[model samples]
Target: MRLRNKPWAKDKLDQYPQYVISGPELLKGKWNGVFDKVQPIHIEIGTGRGRFVTEMAKANPEINYLGIEVQQSVIVTALDRLIEAELPNIKLLNVNAGDVTEFFEKGEVERIYLNFSDPWPKSRHAKRRLTYKTFLKQYEEILINQGEIHFKTDNQGLFEYSLKSFSEYGLLLQYVSLDLHNSNFEGNIMTEYEEKFSKKGHRIFRSEVKYR
Candidate 1:
């Protein structure tokens, strides 16, 4: 979906320095200091409208959740949700996911969430997929040893491709669900895309893969 530009979005994000972090690269390894309490950090790479991250923060107060979304207009909607949530354990980063390693140090993150990412189905665009080998390497660098990546998508092709990529990268598959909502999995937090797709009877694929 093409996002309509919000002229006021940048100013709104700048106004809330507490919720929307600026100059995230400066905080690189010192992320723990940003929150009121030092805790394990988990980040959602493309935190669309902030529903999943905010809900997760509400459910897991002991953990800190950092939401990364590159688009200013899209992230501004998320910022609005965060403002209403008023959760101290959550923060937003309006930066590109491709540059993630620059903002985090080795073992700085405990977990990563890839929820309903763009499929990028063309063969030539395979590398642009979030589960591509290049991205896996970046995720491995910032995540702790044995750190897990929880992924969900309504696109079967992307799920299958990601599984193969994870296997090739030597990641251990902890769980896999072909039809997530129909499966017995518990504590599922649905993203905006997930909800829309599932409501249309789409099968949701989910997996948990851990680093070696």
Candidate 2:
């Protein structure tokens, strides 16, 4: 799906510096200082429209949530949700996921969330997938020892590939569900994509992998 460019999105994002952080790299290891309360940090990469992260923040007040999205238009929608939610534990990052390491120091993050990320199905583009080894290595760098990555997707191929990738990277798979909504998993917040796909009878695959 092509994202329509919003010419005024940048200005809107600038207006809410408290919600959408700027120059995140400057904060690096000092992320806790910016939040209302210093707490375990969990980040959602490709946090489209902010549904999952915002809901997560509302559900878990003790943990700070960061929603990262590269596109200004997409993230602007998330900013709107943040503005309405007015949750003190959530912040947004309008930056590329590839540069995540630049904004976080080693062991700065306790958890990472990947939800319905672009599959990048072609073999040549495998490296671009968020679950690819390259990206996993980046996650490993900033994540605390035994930090967990919770991933969800409707694409079976990507799920299978990610399982192999996570295992090969030596992450211990603590949980796996081929059909998440039907499983016993509780408190599962649905992303916009997840809701749409599941309504169409798509099976949502989920996994929890820990870097030990």
Candidate 3:
């Protein structure tokens, strides 16, 4: 992942001096300047093309939103959209999801949104799935005590596996819906992949998991 030459890399917006931090060295992390008085921050783990989080930021003025993505290409695309929207409550980060806990302070985030995260369907790649316990533990560290994760995906197997993982990790499965589009749920915002999948008639699986 060389970044010295790419156009997106050269103009990247994430200007943090220490963007990469080790998990063991993150207990004293702080970000008061970037976000003045963290007030109910909502984090979206994989913001592809930035439709969902951006729109959510525009719609909700009180809550701060953070969008994280590892790929420079994707984050660059998302940044372009953010610039277009001129969203003030939104921020961007380019980093691996596995290391998110280290970047955020404890209780800094109030909610998490997992929108169509990579399924990693192969049995051997289960740990790579964002809903796996490994990543949930990372989320737990940064999220407030009662903070909840809102997940939506079109993969049945992954959804079921996620429910099991959430339970195994001691998170309470608060809300579960097999079909999100038809559910009369409120405050629903569909991501880029979600809109396409839903239009194709895929049944979206949704759930909210909180600390039990």
Clashes of each: 0, 0, 0
Estimated TM-score per prediction? 0.99, 0.99, 0.87
Model 3's C-alpha root-mean-square deviation from the true structure amounts to 4.1
Task: Give the candidate order by descending lDDT.
Answer: 2, 1, 3
**Candidate 3 lDDT by residue in tens digits, 104-144:** 88888889999999899999999899988778888888888
Report clash pairs, candidate 3.
none
On a 0 to 100 scale, what is the lDDT of residue 37 in model 1? 97
Off by over 4 Å in 3: 1-9, 12-28
Model 1 ranges with Cα > 4 A deviation: none
Report lDDT (Cα) of residue 50, candidate 3. Answer: 81
Report the lDDT tens digits of candidate 1 across residue range 132-208: 99999999999999999999999999999999999999999999999999999999988999999999999999999
All candidates: CA RMSD in angstroms?
Answer: 0.6, 0.6, 4.1
Cα miss at 180, model 1 (Å)? Answer: 0.3
- Give the runs in model 2 whose Cα sits over 4 Å from its true position: none
Q: What is the lDDT, from 0 to 100, of the residue 121 in candidate 3?
A: 94
